[model samples]
Target: MSPAEQAGTQPELTYEQARDELLTVVQRLESGGVPLDESLRLWERGEELAAACQRWLDGARARVEAARRARTPDEAD
Candidate 1:
C-alpha cells in the first residue's frame, strides 16, 4: 500500500480527521482550477469522506441513546 493509505488514508479515520479532510476537499473543489478527471476524483473522495463522517456520528448517537436508556430510573430523581 502507498504510505498515505498505510498511514493517513487507512482503513479508518476518526470523525474529526475525516471531517477535516472533507473540509479540505470542499475547499479544493470550490477553488475551481483542477482538471475534469481530477475534479471528479476529488468529488468522489469527498463523498466517501462525508459518508465516513456520518458513520462515526451515527455510531456516537446510537451509543448515547443506549446509555440514556441504560440509566437507572432513580438517576432521573
Candidate 2:
C-alpha cells in the first residue's frame, strides 16, 4: 500500500496537480538515469496520479451529463 493509503489520508489533489505530477514522473522515467528501485517507485506514483486524474475527469463528465439531462425536455409526457 502507498504511504497515503497506509496513513488513511489520501491527499485531495486537483486534476491539474495530479496531471503535472504524472508528467514529472514520466519525464524522470524517460530520462534513464534513475536506479531500478527508484524507477519502480516513480512508476507506482505515476499510476496513482493517473488514477486520481481519471477520477477527476469521470466526475466532471458525470456532472456535464447530468446538466445536459436537466436541460433537455422530457418527451415522456
Cα RMSD of all models vs. native, in order, equals 6.4, 4.8
lDDT of 2 by residue, 1-77 (tens): 33334336576587888899999999999999999999999999999888888777777898899999999998896
All candidates: TM-score: 0.79, 0.86
Pick out the ten consecutive residues of candidate 2 with the lowest summed lDDT: 1-10
In order, candidate lDDTs are: 0.82, 0.84
Writing each residue's lDDT as its tens digit, candidate 1 over 18-60 gives 8999999999999999999999999999998998787777777
- Give per-residue lDDT, candidate 2, residue 72: 95
Question: How does residue 27 of candidate 1 score in lDDT?
Answer: 97
TM-score of 1: 0.79
